[model samples]
Each structure stands twice: as structure tokens, then as C-alpha cells.
Target: MEMSEIQAARLLLGGDGRAGQAASRQVGQESASVRYGEVKSVDAEAGTMTVLLDGQSQEITLTDSTASTRLKAGDRVKIVKQGQSWVIDLAGGISRALDTAVSEANARMGAHDETMAQQQAAIEAAQAELAGMDRKISDAVDTAISQLETPDGGNHIYAGADEPTPPKDGLKAGDLWYQTNASGQIAAVKVWNGTVWNGYDMVANSILVAGSVGSTLIADGAVTTAKITAKAITADQIAANTITGAEIRADSVDVNEIASGDIYCKRLTATDGAGYTEMTGNKLEMLDSGSRSLVAIWVEGGVCYINANLAEKISIGTNSGSVLNISNGGFIFSSMMPGFRVNGVSAVESFAIAPGSATESFSANVPYSPHKTSYAVVYYRCTYTDTAGSVKFPITEGGSANVVLKELTAFEAADESIALGCAENITVALGNSPNKTFAITRGNPYRFAIKPSGNSVNANPGSQFEITQVTLCGQ
Candidate 1:
């Protein structure tokens, strides 16, 4: 993340500001700079952590216990100046692009494994149905072979000459030439050799019918994929759950073989999309590589939660386009930013002075609306210590970045008409405008200051004019 982009960054680097001049470190104060990094490793015993900053690894000590508790490897942290020394803290709002990329790769591999399992199950079912058909074909082949005769080099169909006609439905008499058994029976009469026989014999003009195709006729391992017609076996031929995991070969099925359908998986990833979708805790979530929600939908107890995530802003509208857009810049509706009059004023900035001492003269950040609302009132309460004078606040731009500035903005609160008197236990509400609402920008924090309105500070540096509370009102 860029240092300049960090909202929490307090910098004193010698970079040219919006103004021509850059701020320099003043005497007797430590200069500081803010930078971001990823934690590589943490050693609580050693009081240090190895961090990757700007593509380089560097070791930094953990001086703050709070920061140490929040840090771990793969987490990002920022090195910032705190008081007199540099300290490490978790970096808020910094981009974690590297970690997100790694997550996406892992998700893709998981999806691949799940897809392979489903394909294997489907292919195995087809193999079982193929085996069943092999039994039926074998029996038909054997019946023809037994009736073969000489003069045919290989088996061929029999001719009508001296050949018995085939049966219509079942085996019958007169379909073949029969010789008398050892018992010496008459022509076309029943006869038996040794085995027990049923009382039946061949009759005239009757035909022999083929018997059931027996499993014993077919040799094991005779049928294979080469013997079957392509696409002949379908789902109807294969029984459900007939194929088990043991019947499948490793990596036998691939994506090319699978037809388009719904894929159910624990984790599904697509590299082209750079994200993953998964089910967790009964909620289905689709997330980007960064783990930020891209889109999600789930139902529980008749209630559904649908989520779509966008950075910094969200818009809602019809098919035409967006009618309402909510962002850090504030709500913009149909090409217009919402406007409220001064009567709708609210506190935009507020801070308390020390119990007895006033806050030091420094450039602290103040909230400003992107729509450029105007501030109108300066309010404060001070208990007087026999002191009588007014302290008007004059806010300005281009304040120094130092923790303490030796000079102040040219405008004094006195230069403006508004006056805040130093009276005991009294509250003051002075109308401050024209100067209070200075140069502004959208969606950014501006720098405001508290300093002497003249000799009010250098002469009376005690609780005589100490502010109990102060608030900046904007509309």
C-alpha cells in the first residue's frame, strides 16, 4: 500500500505538499515516517518479527504488546512513529494481493479433485452394463458352432440341403436327423442310453427352438471396450450404484469426457475468475481471492441472505441504471449530492482539552464531507481565572506536518469578528464562517489547528483560558 494513501499515517517526509513548500522536522522533536509490510514470522521470546516490506525482508522489534497480540505470519503490519520510537501495528485497509493469489490456487486444486470423483462414478456404471451384454452374445455364438459341418473352412450358415429347419419358439421334433440309441428303438421313436429320460420324442414336420443363452457358454475376460459399439450402452442398461470405487482406474476420466451439468463440491474454484465458491455452516458463499465476498446466497429456516460486496460504494436502481449510490463521499442520488441547510447542522469535529492545560498547537485531522458542507459555529467553554479576552479560532490550510509547529496560519481568531471570552464556568457560541469554511476537497480529512490568536497564549499559558470542550459544527 502506498504510504500517502494510509489514512492513519502521520508523516514528516520531505515531499512537496499541495503547497510549493514541504515540511521539515523542527528542533527537539523526533522525525517519523510510515510504511507498510507483511509479517513473515514472529518470535515472542526474541521480541522481534521478520516482515516483508517493499519486496524485502527486514526484522523489527515489537515494542507494543497490543501490536504483538494482533500480528502473525501472513498478516500485514505497518511500522509507524509512536512518540519517540517506531512501532509495529496491524495495517488497516492495506491491500493484500499476494495472500489472495495463493488462496485462489488452492481452491482450484480442490475443485479439480471433486470433479474427477464424480466422473469416475459415471464411467464405472457404464463398464458394469457392458459386462452383462457379453453373457448374452456368447450363448448365441455357441449354438451355431455345434451345428457346423465339414467343407466349411470357417463357420458359415447352413444350406437347405439335408439341413433341418430352425425352431419357431422352442425346441421341437423333426428339426434334426436322429439315430436310434443303444436300446434299439424304431424310426423316429424315443430311446435312451443310461440316464433317466422324460417320455418325449421327435415328431414329423416339427422344428427345433433355441434354448436360453447360458452364462457357462461365454469365456471369462472375452468382452472389452473394443468389442462394444460406441455409445450403444446408455444409462438404462446400467443399474444404479452397480459400480463402486474399486472398479475405477486412476485418472481414467477427465473434464473433456464430462457433459455439462451441475457440479456439487465442497470448494469450487475458477482461475479465470480468480475466486472460489464453497459451502460453510449451511451458507453458500462465493468469494474473491482476497476472501472478500463477491456474491453469496444461502437459506436457513425459511430466511435467505444474499450478499454482494463492492469497495467503498454501493448503488441501487432499476434496469435503466443506478438511482442511488452510497459511498464514502456520501449519498449521491441521480446525479445529485444530498443537501441540508444550516438549520440541519451537526457536529463534524470535536475534542476535549486537557483537564487543566489547553491542547497544543498542532495540525490535527478534521472531518469534511465530500459534498463540501459549510461550518458555521465555533463553540467552547472556559472557566476564567481573572482573565478577560476573547479567543477566536481561525482555521487555515497548508499547516506544517511537524508534531509541533513554531508558526501558525496568518489569520488570527481576533482578525475575524468572532470572539470567545475567558470567563469562569461559562459557555460561548460564536458565529464563525467565511473563514472557518476554507479550501476543501471531497472524501478526505482536512488539517485544522489550535494555536495562539495573538499574545493570548505566550502571555497567559495557564488555565485562565483553558477550554473544557470544543466542537466544530457543519451543515
Candidate 2:
């Protein structure tokens, strides 16, 4: 049967339900009885309950008590019969006492969770520190490897036909023993002995220049004749002033090898037809095709001779436009060309001409000197106007008799130098003369004649004229 609050409270409070009280229970079969059973149903109004006892349902009355505890179906209890009163031992009554222990266990579990979170954060920080250490170690290893690379940053074998420029300042121990050229052949091995490269130098003269290939470095006389090829050493490969007369071996210089450039030796003999040059006992000669001397310098005469065609002109001085030019003019100057005056003055004041068919003339002596020049110039100032032709000079001069003139057709015009029309204060120059040259003397007179035009009429002693500055100018 279901236990009531009064019975449960009594069982829990040990009200006639303890083993001590069981001593007071009657031991006889009909005196008192006790049984263990599960309640199947309860009826609160009837104060009765149905319980399973020994696998059978039994109806039992619930006893009331001052305790307020209650029980329902499914309650496990031990029922005790003492005369007419009943006592119950309830299982629910024991479970109520364990609540405090369960609460304490829950609080401990929460504290453990908080400790785990703190440990996790600390582990992450340790991992970050380890990563930074890894980077530092990696940097240290890289620096060590770089130091192990070379004395300089790079001291490997050099390449290319040109030379190499090794670093000047670097670690001092390791030296560059040799370097290769652009042809991939190892040239003269230069050993850099911590301080300098051992070799022959020209500019510095103590150590090798950066142009370190194709030169000797071991010592003097180290290079044998077998190392040299025929005509291998040209002029450009030798440094200036380094190869002197004392070091030169006899007949070592092949004249054919000097294709161009001047060679200043005491004597040089070249082969025939090879831009020939030879120094003999008396003269130094330069040849053209082979035997013909283009130029020669003779020690006996102390004169430099030029043998060429007459068309060649000798030029002197080096300036832009101003220079002494010696050309083959038809009128050659012997010593000097002094000036000559027509009438001992620069001008002839008055000149007169006669009437038609009769000509007035002027004449002067040559003074037995060079009285004519290469140029012909004439000028006149007019004081008269007449139909007479201009005063004219003979085209050919200088003879005791009639002057020898070439064919008349050689001159197509009366005078190409002067204009036909006359004007006051006019001047004319025959600077562009013909190629023919002439001599001048008193034998042939100037005449200075003027003839009137054909079919023209004129007055007597007509139109007296003025001739000013009739000079044969020098070219």
C-alpha cells in the first residue's frame, strides 16, 4: 500500500520503524506481521492503497499521522504490522540526504574548466616565442654561409677576352690563383699575393694593371719563344716607351708587319713593291710602285726633293684661308715685281683727239724694266662729249718693230674688259685676261689712239678727254 505522509515521516523519523522498535514487535505469527512491497495504486479519500506484495496485489489502509509527508504509486516500502497500527520504511526518504554532496562536485568541475583555458593561452604564447627563435636561427645560418663564400664577395674564374677587375678590399687570406679569358683559355696566371698581383706593369710599374691577360707574371725570361706566334705581337699590344732599343733583338722587326705608320730607326730596308722605303749611304728614299722615288732626302745636298708632275702645287702654312700658295703661273716672278708709273704721276691730266680720219696718240718709254703687269686697268673722267671711240691701247706690246699678234679670231671682241658706252668717272679692269702672256719695252708705243665711228662726222680738235690712273695692276 502507498505510504501516507504520516507513515513516511514516521518511517524516516524512525517512529516505530527502526530495528530497536522491532524488538517490541511481536514474534508470533498472529501477534504482529511485516512485509515489503511496491504500491500499485492509492486512494486518498478512502485512505486505502493497492500494493504488490509477493507478486500479488493487496489492498491496505493508510494510517494518518501528524507528519505531512505523502507517498504515491511506485513507492517501495516495508510495511510493519504492530497490533492494529502499521509502520512503513520508504526508499524516497533516503535519497533526500545526498543533495549537498552533488552540489560540491559541480562547483569543483567548473573550477577545472577555468584552469584548462588558462593553460591553453600559455601554450599559444610559448609557440609564438618558438617561431621567433626559429627565424633568428635561420638568419644566423645565412650569415655564416655568406662569410664562407669568398675572400671577396666573388673571386671565381674570370671570363671574356677583356680583362677582369677584382675587388681591391676584401678578406685577405684566399687569393685568386688564375683566371680564364673569353676564349676559355687560361692566360698568364697572375697570383694575387694578399697585397698585390705579381706582374710587369707600365703605368704603375710595380704590380699588374686590371688588364691582366696575355702577359707574363712569374718572372723575367719566363716567356719562351714557343709561346709566341708569328706576327702575334702588334704595336698596340706593347705599352708606350716600354720597349726600348736595348731590349730589342736584331732583325726582330719585320718591315712588312708595319703596314702603316712611321718607323724612326737608323736604317730600314723594305721589300720591293711593299710601300718601299730604304736608307742608303747618302739619301733616304720613299718609293711609289717600286723603284720610282716619290720623295728623297739627301744628306750631301741637305735638300728634300720632291719628284712629281708639274701640276702638283706646294702648300705652305696651316691656316683657314690665308696661306702662301706657289702655283705655275705663265708669268713667273723671278725676284720681285716693282711698280712702274706711266708719266711719273698717278694720272694724266689732259688728253686731246683730232678730227675725223686723223688720230691723236700718247706714248711712253718702258725704262728697260718690267713695265707691264698681269692685270690691265683703265679709268677716265670726262670733260667732253664727242662721236670718237674711247682711247684704246694695243693688245700686243714689247717689240722693236710690229708686235706679233696671234690670229685675230683669238679675240672676238674689241675689248671684253670695257663697256661700249662712255660715262664720266668710269673705271675698267681686265683682271680676267686671256691665258697668253707678253713682255713690255719702249720699242712698241702705247699710241693711246681713238678713232671715230664709221659714217660719222666730227669737228676739228674735237672733244679733248681726261685719262685718270691707267695702271697695269698686279694680280
Candidate 3:
């Protein structure tokens, strides 16, 4: 058994039981010694080395078999204590220390290489990603260039700038180009028409040359009246019947423009024998030189006829007889009037009235004056009930029963007292029964009245009467 140096030293210094036992068990044994330190300095001739041990300086002697000559400052060495002296251990000394250090250095170098390899791989991946990004950027730039530049047709698609000059080569038909002229000025744009280049003038205020007016060049409503010369539109310029009545402005067409035979009328005079002949010319002259009268002239049978009076009688329709005539005053018809015309002042009394049990009279106020000589006719229509035994009669003042003829002067007369009678000169009848209408010569009363016969009539009190119409007329 051998005692380690630490145990022997502890026992020699009066150590505890564990160290004392270790020394006692190997009292005769040699002490095993080993120490490790970095060599601080070395003396080959003296076979001694100054070493740093546990942060303290120590001098150790090398044995005859030790390689102390190979030791240098900063070298790590393992030493053993022998007989109160320290010496490098040959079995596990600087060689073993160098070997352990080499192994550790190799491991660190291996770790550093792995880290470098990882970094290299990361850089390569980043480069590849950057390459892809560059390719995308290049593609985007190419696409942008394609959009901005002209196409194969060599036409400049962009506007509001100077046109491209000389154009791109290999241009097809309809390719447009622009270039400086001989005067070194930008010339008109030219279009390639396969065989030749045709200049297209886009200058403002340029006049359209002859044969240049095409349908595509003219917009609707582009041609206005101001653009046309006076009388430039002739009869041939207008399509047949295209000008409707509404399109013709009022008084725009002169009389000279109207054809004479186009004025068709059934009559032109008031007299039956006097009528217009057929118009022969295309012109009608209406001239009034003097202030006396206005005249209308027409052409018939190559003869011009003039008429100053348009109101003469004329035959119309298939009758060849005078059906209508117009005088200076008005119109007259030989037969019945064409339409009912209001003759004179008229009034309507359309109110319901209840007559008394006794005979009573009803009259309409006349607003018109009587004719001095000629007879004025009064027209009236009334509705009333005639009792079974009652006798009703229309009458005027100052007339006898059923036989009076002269006109009455009184405006109002009693019904029962003055039993006036119908005028003999005037015709009276119970037209349409219970509704009577009659005409009488006008007199002073200027009002019409209806009365029941006082002597023989027994009027019904509940009988209702109404005067619907009254009119007066005179020649």
C-alpha cells in the first residue's frame, strides 16, 4: 500500500482520524505525489521550473528522466512530490497535457467549422431568395416597358405629346408615324397605307379639300343654316313631300312659291254665276296698290283674272245652284240657313212656378226695344198643366178674347180682370200641348205673358208652370 502525499502531509501535521488511519495503514509505504500547474518559468541547467499552482508561485525540480527542456512558460505540466522536492511526472506530464489540449483545440475547431458551414448554407439560401426577387423585378420591368412603348404597328398610342419620329421598323399598313420635315419642323402625321405614306392634316383651321367630304367626316346637325348660302336650297334639293306642314314656318313660303292650281276652293264669289276658273300658272298675285280695296288675282286658261269682291254669290256642291251667299253685310241663304244663328236679344226663364187657384198670368221681362215700323217678333215657349175643365190662353194687353190683333202698350196687366186675348195678326197655337210657343208682333209692353181665361177657366192651384225660352227678332 502507498500513502498519497495529501494524506501523509496531513498525518505529519497532526490531521484527523481519516488521514491518520490512512498514514497508519501505510506507515512503511511510499507517498504517492502528483501536482498540476502552468509553468511560469523554467531553468534547464538547474533542472528547476517556476510554476503557478493554485494561483501561487512554486519552484519544482525535474528528474533526470523528465523532459524539462521541452517545458516553457505558459505550458501546463503535471508534477509529483518526491523526498521534499517536486518533479514532473513522466507518465502523466506535459505530453499528456499537450495531448489533452490538442484534443480540446480540435473539438473547438470542429465546432467552429460546423458554425461556418451553417452560416454558409444560410447565405446561399438568402442569395437564392434574392435571385428570385431580382427575377420578379425584371419581369415587372419588362411588362411595364411593353405597356409604355409602341406596338408592332409603330403607332404612338399615347396622346398629348409629340408623336414618335420615323416610327418603328417593320411597320404594317395603317401604321402612323411622324417626322421632321425638310424645314426641320415637325410635319403632319402620316399613315402607312401599305404602298405609300399619306399625310393626314390635323391642323386647326384647315379647309376640307374637294372630294374629302365623306359621310364619316360629317356629324349630324353639323351643317347649319348659317353655313348655307341664300337660296342655295332649291326645289331639287328637297325630297319630294318631305317638307310637312309643321316644318314650314309661318309666312316663310311666299305666294310666288305656291302653285296657282294648288289653291282649291269650292267657291270664290257670292253670286252663283260668278266663280273662279282653274288656275293655270304656278304663281298667284295678291296686290293692293291703292287704299281703296284689296284685290286677289289668279290665272285661269292662260288668262289672268282679278276680283275685288270675294263676297259674291256662288253655287256649291252638286246642285249647281246658289246654296250659300255672302254679302258685304253678312251671309244669306236662298233656302234654310246652314246652321241655327242667334237672331237677336234673348232671355231664358227656366224657374218653376205654382199658379194660384184662380186664373193668373206669368210674363218674361223684355230687355230689347221695339222696331219703329217693321214688326219685331217675340218667341216664347212655356210649360203648364191645363186642368180638365180649364181654358188657358196667351194674351197681350188691349186685346179682346181670342180675337185681338193690335199690339198692347201696357207693360203689366192683371190676369183675372183684364181678360186679354191673342192678337189676330200673330199666329198662336198650343204647340206640343201644355207646352205652348207663339210669336207676336212687338209692342210697348215688351214682355210676354200667359193667362188663364177668367170667364170659363177653373185653374188648379197645384198646377206648375215654367217658361223655358224667350227670344226676339226683327228685320
TM-score for each model: 0.21, 0.20, 0.25
Model 3 residue runs over 4 Å out of place are 1-35, 50-68, 80-92, 149-475
Cα displacement (angstroms), candidate 1, residue 222, comes to 39
lDDT of 2 by residue, 1-475 (tens): 4555554433423334334564454444422355555666676666556555533333444553311146678766566665556665454333432454577888898898899999999999999999999999967754453334444555433323344455456524343334446664656655455677554222332343245563534345243232343654655344342343434565454433444365566544455445677788776677665467666766556655544443344444454432333444322111122222333332111122212211122333222123333333333333333322222232223221222211111112464331122222222222113332222221111112233332222343222443432333232
Which candidate would rank higher by lDDT, 1 or 2? Answer: 1
Against the reference, the lDDT scores of all candidates come to 0.42, 0.41, 0.42
Error of 2 at 12 (Å): 99
lDDT of 3 by residue, 350-397 (tens): 121222211223333332323211111222221232211112233332
Candidate 3 global lDDT: 0.42
Model 2, residue 468: C-alpha shift (Å): 16
Q: What is residue 212's positional error in candidate 3, in angstroms?
A: 48
Candidate 2 — which pairs collide?
A: 5-69, 160-182
Cα RMSD, model 3:
31.5
State candidate 3's TM-score: 0.25
